[model samples]
Target: MLIETLKNRLVLACLILIGLYAVVSIGGTLFFQYEPNSQDLLQANTGPGAVHWLGTDYLGRDLLARIVYGIRISLTIAFFATLINITVGFLVGSVSGLLGGLADRLLIGMVDIFWCIPPFLIVVMLTVVLEPGIKNIFIALGLVLWIPTARMIRGEVRVIRNSPFIKFARLNGAGSFQIMARHILPNCIPVLLTTAAFSIPDAIMAEAFLSIVGLGVQAPNASLGVLISDGLQSFRVYPWQWFFPVLTLTMLVLCFNILGDALHEAYSSKAKGLLEHD
Candidate 1:
C-alpha cells in the first residue's frame, strides 16, 4: 500500500512541494540574509532584483523573507492546531463510541450541534472573544475544527468495536484502553491521516482569513494573509507584494488538498480490496 501510494505521480509531486515548503519554512533563516521584519525605507516598494528576489513590501522589508517566515508561522499554527484538534476529537469520539448508550447519544448530540454551525464562524467568534495571538488562534481553531473528525471517528470506532478481532481481544482480557490503544487506533490510521491532511489546509486558510481581517498574527510578524492585506494598498502599483504571498498560499493549500485526496483514494482502494477478499 505504501509503495503504491508513493508510485502515484500526483501524490509524489504534492509531497515534494509540501516537503520543499516545510524545509524552507523551517530552515529559512540559515539561507536568507534578511529578517522578515527588517526594514529599509530607501528600498521600499522596489521590484524584484538581485537584492530582493521576490521584491520589497511597502516598508522595504524583504518579501521573500517575509513570505518564508509567513509560511513557517502558518504551518506551525496549523500543525499545533491540528494536533489539538485530533487529540480532542479522538478522545471524544473514542469514548463516546466505546461507552455507547447515553454517553454516545450525548456526545454525538453535542458534536452535531457544533457540526451545524459553520466552523469559520465559530473560529471567528472565538478569536473575537479571546485575545488575538498565535496561541489564541490555535485554541480557536482547535476548538472548532474537530467536529468532522469527531463524527467520523465516532462512526469508525463504533464499527470497529464490534469487529471479531475486538471481541477476541476482549475475551482475552484486554481492557478498553488496551484494545483502543493496540487495536482500534491502528485500524483508524487511514481515517486519521486523511482527516489530518484535510484539517491542516483548513487551519492554514482559517489563519490567513483571520489575519486578512486584522484579527490574527499582528504586524511586524508576517503571515501570508497579513502580507496580502498590506499588499492590497499598493496592489495597483506594486503587485508583487500580494502576488507572491497569494501564489505561495495557493500552492500550499493545493498541495495539502491533493495529498489528502491521494491518501483517501489509496485507503479507500485498500479497504475495497480487503472487503472483496473477505
Candidate 2:
C-alpha cells in the first residue's frame, strides 16, 4: 500500500538523491585528490575526458573537483543556516503564539521590521563594508531568512494554541515553559520539519547568489555560484563549466523540494488516519 502511493515514491527518490549528495559532499573531500584551485595554463579549456570526468576550466582546474567542493560548501551553508533559522523561528513563534495580546503584537511588529527591510541592500552593504567570505554569507542569509520562518511558525501555532491539548497541559499545573515545550512545541513538529526541509534550497541559492556577486567564498574557493560565475565569462568557448554546476544546483533544489512535499503529505496522511481511528 505504501509503495503504491505517490508520496512514498517521492520520499524514496528524495532519500536516494540526498544520500548520494551526502556521500559526494563528505567523501569527495577526503578521497578525491583533484585540486580545485591548482591551475595549469597548458591544460586549460580541455573538454571532458577520461582524466577529468567533467572537464578543465579556462584555468585548467578539474571541473569534477570544483563541483565536489562546491556541493560541500552549498550543503554546509544550507544545513547550518537552516538550523539557525528554525531554532530562532521556533522560539520567537512559540512565544508569540502562546502568549497573545500586546506582547504578540509587539513581537510581530519586530518581525515585520525585519521582513520589511530590503535583503539585497543588506547583502550589498555587508559585502562592501566587510570582507566577502563564507561566514559573512551565512550570517547575512540567516538574518534575512528567519523572518519568513518566524511568521509561518507563528501562524501555525496560533491555529492550535487554543486546542484541548494546550488547555489540558495548562490545567495540569504546567508552567508556561512546560506547556509550550512539552505540548505546543511537540505538536508543531510536523509543520516545523516541512518548513525546514523547504527552506534548505532557498538557503543554498542565497549563498550561491552571494558568491556570484563576489560576497561569498573567496576567489580561491569553489562554490556552485562561484563556478557558475566563472563559467559565464568563458561561456562562448566552454559550456561544460556552466552546465555541470548549474545542473548540480538545480538537482539539489529539486530534491529538497520533493522531500519537503513528500514529508508534508506523509505527515498529513498519518494525522488523518489517527483522527479517523479515534
Candidate 3:
C-alpha cells in the first residue's frame, strides 16, 4: 500500500528520466564510439546527414558524439560533485545538530557566511584562480553548493533529534555515535535523499553556466555548455548545433528537478502518515 502511493506518475517519470540518463552516460560513453575532440575541417559546420546523425560542428567534429560525451561528462561531474557536497553538508549539519553548543554556533556561522555571499561570484573567482579544468570546477562547485544541503540536514536533524524514539535510545544507554547512526540518521534519510537529489540539478546548471562563460571545462573536452556556446556563434546558419544541446540540458535539468520534487512529496507523505500513526 505504501509502495503503491510512491509508484504514481511522477515517480515513474522520474525513473524513466534517470534510466535514460544512465543509459546515455554509461552505455553511450562506453559502447558508442567516436572521438568528441577529433576534428575534420572538410566536414565542419555541415547540417545533419546520414553520416553525422546530428551534424558536424564548427571544427567538423561529430556533434552526436560530442553530445553523448558531453552528457556523460556533465552527469559524471555533477554526480561526484554532489556526493562531495552532500558529504560535507551531512558532516557539518549532523555534528551541529547532534552536538549543539559552541560548535553548532561556529558551524552554522560558517554556513551563514557562505550563504550570504553569491555562490556564483565565488565560483567565478575560483575559476580565475584555479583555471578552467574538470577537477577544479568540480571542487569549486562542490565547495559553494554545500551550504543549502547543510541547512537542510541541520533542520531535519534537529527535528528528528527530539523524537521520543531518540529519547528512548538515549535511555537505553546508546552512545552518541550509535544513536546517530541507528536512530537519528535513519529518521533523517528522507531529508538527506531529497536534499542530495535536488543538489544534482543545481550543480549541473552551475557547470553549464560556467562552461558557457568560458570559466568551465577547457577546449578539446566536450561539455554541454561549451557545445551550446559554440553553437551560438553559427546558430543562424546551422541551428541544430545549438538547438540539440540546449534541448538536452533543459530536459536533463527538468527531469532531475521533477525527480527530486517527487521524492520530496513521497517522503513527506510517508512521514506524515507515520506521525499520525504514532
Candidate 4:
C-alpha cells in the first residue's frame, strides 16, 4: 500500500522521457553522421529554418547535430561516474559500518577530511594537474563524488548492522563477511539504491560545471555545457546559441531529479512499512 501510494505517475513519465532521449542520442550517433563540427560560412548563425531546424552555430555547425552528440557524451560521462561512485561508496561504506573500532574510525576520519575539501575546488585542482578531457573529468569527479556517497552508505550500514536479522545471522555462526553479504547488505539496499538514483543528476550537473570551466568536453565535442559557454559570448546578438543548449540541459537535469526523488520516496516508504511490521 505504501509503495502504491509512492508510485508517482509524473516521475514515471519523466523517466520514460529520459530513456527515450538517451536512445535517440545514442542511436543517432551510431547510425548517422550530421557533422558536429563541420562549418559552413554560408549557413552561419541562421535562425531556425527548414534546412537547419535548430539553426547553425557561430561556425555554421548544425545545432541539432551538436546537441545530439553532446547529449550522448554528457550522459555517458554521468553514467560512468555514477557507477564508479556507487561501487566504491558501497564497498567503503559497508565495510566501515559493519566493522566498528579502528576500521570505522579510520574510514570516518577519511570521509570527514574529504568533506572538508570542496568538490569543485578538487576538480579544478585536478584539472590543473591532469590533462583536461572527457576521461579526466570522469576520473576527477568520480574520485571526489564518492566521498559523500560513502558517508551516506556508512551511516546506513551502522543502522542495518544492528538489525534483528543481522543479529540472528551472526548468532548462527555467520562470519562477518557472510553477515554483510547475506543480511546486512540486503537491508542496505534501500539506502544504496536511493543514493545511486540521486547521484545521476549530480554527476550530470557536475559534468556541465567542469565543461563550463574550460576543463571538460573539449572543443568540437558540443556538450550542452560547452555549447552554453560558447553561446554566452554572443548572448546579446545570437541568443539561440545559448538558449537551446541551456534548455536541453535544464530539462535533462529536471527530469533526472524528479525521477530520483520519486524512487527515493517509494523505497523510504517501503522501508518504513517493513520496520513497522517488525
Task: Point to the candidate with the largest lDDT.
Answer: 1
lDDT of each: 0.89, 0.82, 0.84, 0.81
Give the runs in model 3 whose Cα sits over 4 Å from its true position: 1-6, 29-33, 171-173
TM-score of 3: 0.92
TM-score of each: 0.97, 0.89, 0.92, 0.91
Q: What is the lDDT of residue 194 in candidate 3?
A: 80
Q: Give one digit per residue, the lDDT tens place, for model 1 in 119-200.
A: 8889989999997888899899999878888888898898779989989999999998898789878888888888889999
Clashes of 2: 0
lDDT of 3 by residue, 1-278 (tens): 22653577876776687777779767764755567888999999888889888999988998988988898888877887888888888878888898788989999999999999999999899878998888888888888888888888888888778778888988999877787788767777777778777888888899999988889888888778889989998899999999999998898888888777877888888879989998
Q: Model 1: runs farther than 4 Å from truth?
A: none
* Order of quality (lDDT): 1, 3, 2, 4
Error of 4 at 64 (Å): 0.8
Error of 1 at 272 (Å): 1.3
Judge candidate 3 against the unseen true structure and give its global Cα lDDT, from 0 to 1: 0.84
Q: Which ten residues in a row have the lowest lDDT in candidate 4?
A: 1-10
Model 4 C-alpha lDDT per residue in residues 185-255, reported as the tens digit of each score: 67767666667667777877888887887888887676778888888898788888889989998989898
- Judging by TM-score, tell me the better candidate of 1 and 3: 1
Listed per model in order, the count of residue pairs whose N, CA or C atoms clash below 3 Å is 0, 0, 0, 0
Q: Candidate 2, residues 91-210: lDDT per residue as tens digits? A: 888888889799899999999987877877766676667677777677666666678878877887898888898888788888877887888788778877887888889888877888
